[model samples]
Target chain A: MKRNPLVPIVVAAIIAVMLFAGIHSARKNRAARSPSVSGQVHGKDAPDFELQSLEGKNIKLSDFRGKAVLLNFWATWCGPCKIEMPWFVELQKEYGPQGFQIVGVAMDDSSTEDITKFVREMGINYPVLLGKEEVGQSYGGVNALPTSFFIDRDGKLVAREFGLQSRSVFVDHIKEALNQGQPVQAQK
Target chain B: MKRLFLCSLVLLAAAALGQDAPTMKPVVSMAPAPLTTITQGKASQVPLAFRVIRGYHINSNQPKSEFLIPTALKIGATTDIIIGGTDYPEGHDMSFAFAPDEKLNVYTGDFQVDVSVRPLRSVLPGKYMLRGNLKYQACDNAACYPPKQLPVSFEVKIAKAAPAPRKNPAQSPHSHK
Candidate 1:
């Protein structure tokens, strides 16, 4: 029997193509699985959204264009969110004078009354808006509670943190947000 | 042939690396339930096993705090079968890194829920399917995921009740004589 010299080479070529395709697909999936804030949308303009506040007033993200904003997504059922609410309150007071604003978006299914009660109990000094699914999707899917995004005064997203990070991390991000953007009068 | 072997090795290594990557999403899976057999008009307990992905915990049916969302099972209504109360296992009281001072009642790893099911006496003796949803909210050391409802289903085989003993004649003494 005569053996063909190109038989093995053709087979190897097929396997090589398959392996390359597999690796490329795996890398793409890994990137998709990663959290959006982890280098996916850094330095990009923060997605704007209009949500209803606890006071029944329509609030838009652009309303705080001149102030550095800490957009926090949380829920009543989220234990970690509860743990960080107090820290957020204190930080709000500390940075309010420096044109820094902390805006909370309640992503829970609880009623507005319940969220308001929680805010009152926690002594939340900032505006707490009722979160909508579309709004959350716009911000790259708030998969976990206590997800916070820091936007500069120019409305550019500077940083993002998932889960409950140390208070120092929040402070550092806040300082960076305050320093990066121009200071102007915050709208009511 | 050697090049083919090298390609295979590279593919295996890539798969291993992908598997080792950290997962941010929480997963809760239910094991296949064993079919429960019950006599007509009698009650039987069907145990359903569930496993939460490692490094995450969900609140039990009764959490310590009112604010926390508790896991619950709600069976769908059926015409032939009557769904009774569901019994949940007690959660372990543990503290996480986020809240070191406060202990939360949660269910980690594997847990079981016993559901009470009863078949009506008039129901035909055969297998019936039961379906429901288990609603749970999961959290890890640092973050909490939104509440999700995992679809659940199981089979129940109903058997006919044994016939009652025949009653003796009323005039037993006269009949005997």
Candidate 2:
């Protein structure tokens, strides 16, 4: 018996449609699971991690509980990182006394000596800690240098800045986090 | 009807082939064999496909940002073989926290790099292993880590060409001379 001449083309179309639907749904599911936190949102909890500090001490995110945290992921070789380091130092100085802390996670492969030298040269006054691949993964995977996550006193991820944002942007986010501070007694 | 049946068969074969492609391992690794064979004395194309660990991506041959290190492939120098220019796949566009809003060209998952490998006519017949490396800076959505070079060892098997047909001295055009 002879089959329809258009049968193959019709079958191919059906297969293609099915495949497209399957792939699209899979991608949608993945996206729903890890909605890239590319914007500022107040309800999300900041993923906590612990890493070695330059002083050879283990620093955990939970340790900074009840304090507004400005987490900056940077590298010594990043030029834009240098541009923002001094500003970060200044921000830490301005906000440290007010229940605010700046944590610098150096995503570098350089020896401690080199990182230390760069930190000193840049006059980075905040807690400079070493970062690892897993640490980046916890925060939904940071793909760029100088990415910062602003966490309120309650550990809520208030906002995220991917690249080198303006100082005012940093200040504005910090203000939001500070305003979201805990009860007056917790501020002490 | 026969033509339609043939086309359907081809599509099914292609679909199965796609499903059979190997997946990326946890750590960066290279494919076992070149996609195409390398023949001696002739210019043959060899496909070098590197599997980047899942969820992580390396910048394309030309990263958008100057500070980012582009992924590079290099084959070791060998007198027995001549390595020609390489062809890299177009990078997928993805944004990072560092360059918010600006998409960076990168390669994630399994990507193939096609290059020309010419085995010198004089090279002996056997397996020739050439050393190479893929220099890349891996990053996720969160941060970019230090650049790492994954050493690549390419194995090319060369088969000697068939010996020229011998003339019965009587059949040789030069037999008269």
Candidate 3:
């Protein structure tokens, strides 16, 4: 008995659909259990990390728990990151009085001297910490530069933005973070 | 027909997964190179073609900034094959939305690099495989990816050098008698 010519194509399509669904489901399960997976980190607790600041001081993300934090991952070689640096400086000054702080993680492979020179050249006002791969992994593997996460005063992740976004977007997220959580005095 | 169907299914699945994960996609790809033929002791240029994925650009061999990682080709060393200078095409100076005022020297779309190769006269005349790596960092309008190296290889057919010109012998006096 001869089979229909369209049988193979139909069977192949079905198998392809099944395989795609299976892989996607498996990835979803993995992301639920692991913090290193991207696209599934929203609304979760911001991963706390300790890194060295340009002033040769150790800073931890948990130290800023009482203040709303804007954690940004950037690189010196990234042109878009340079553009966002100035805006971040202005945002930090504007929001600092409201108990908001912006933290920069320099995910650069350049030497400390070079990064320090760049930071000085940019006139950055926020604390710029040297980024490590493990810290990046905890935040869902920041494969793209200029990734930012907004944390409320309670240390819950409120929003995350990938790549360079408009200044207004950053402002809106900052306002939301400031309004969402209680201050250290109130918690005490 | 069954084999074709299986291959099509596999490719479709891979495409779907790649779309979901942007990091899994390769930003640059090399085109298949044609085997080059060169005579012994003579230099020949091998042209390699590469294409950057849409919506991305890479720094040229000579980037304007010292901090930028420039795209470069590093060929492996071989005793029989003498590698010479690699020629890179000029980069286009373009500015993106992020940096509208300053232009960065970059390469978009398709680019080519020419490698000079010379086989020693003492080497045998045969096909030799050359291996190398193309190192580059890619970025879009707003974000940059880490630098990556793509493995490269090409075959070169070495030809024998031409025989030296034969010298004419002087005629003997006895031949005239």
Worst 10 residues of 3 chain B by lDDT: B15-24
Best by TM-score: 1
Q: Please provide, for model 1 over A18-121, each residue's C-alpha lDDT reduced to its tens digit, 9 standing for 90 to 100.
A: 66776776676656543334466668999999999999999999999889999999998898898898998999999999889999999989988999998898
DockQ-sorted candidate list, best first: 1, 3, 2
Task: List iRMS (one decimal) for every candidate.
Answer: 4.9, 8.5, 5.8
User: TM-score of model 3 relative to the true fold?
Assistant: 0.79
Q: Quote model 2's TM-score for chain B.
A: 0.71
Q: Candidate 1 chain A, which ten residues in sequence have the lowest lDDT sum?
A: A29-38
Q: Point out where model 1 deviates above 4 Å.
A: A1-38, A185-188, B1-26, B166-177
Per-residue CA lDDT of model 3 for B1-177, tens digit only, reads 778777777767655553443443789999998999999989999999999988889999999998889999999999989999999999999999989999999999999999999999988999999999999999888788888899999999999999867988989999999
lDDT of 1 by residue, B46-136 (tens): 9999999888899999999888999999999999789998999999999999889999999999999999999989889999999999999
Give per-residue CA lDDT, model 3, range A140-173, as digits (tens).
7888887888899989888887777899888888
- Overlapping backbone residue pairs in candidate 1 total 0
Q: Comparing 1 and 3 by DockQ, which wins?
A: 1
Q: DockQ numbers for every candidate?
A: 0.37, 0.07, 0.23
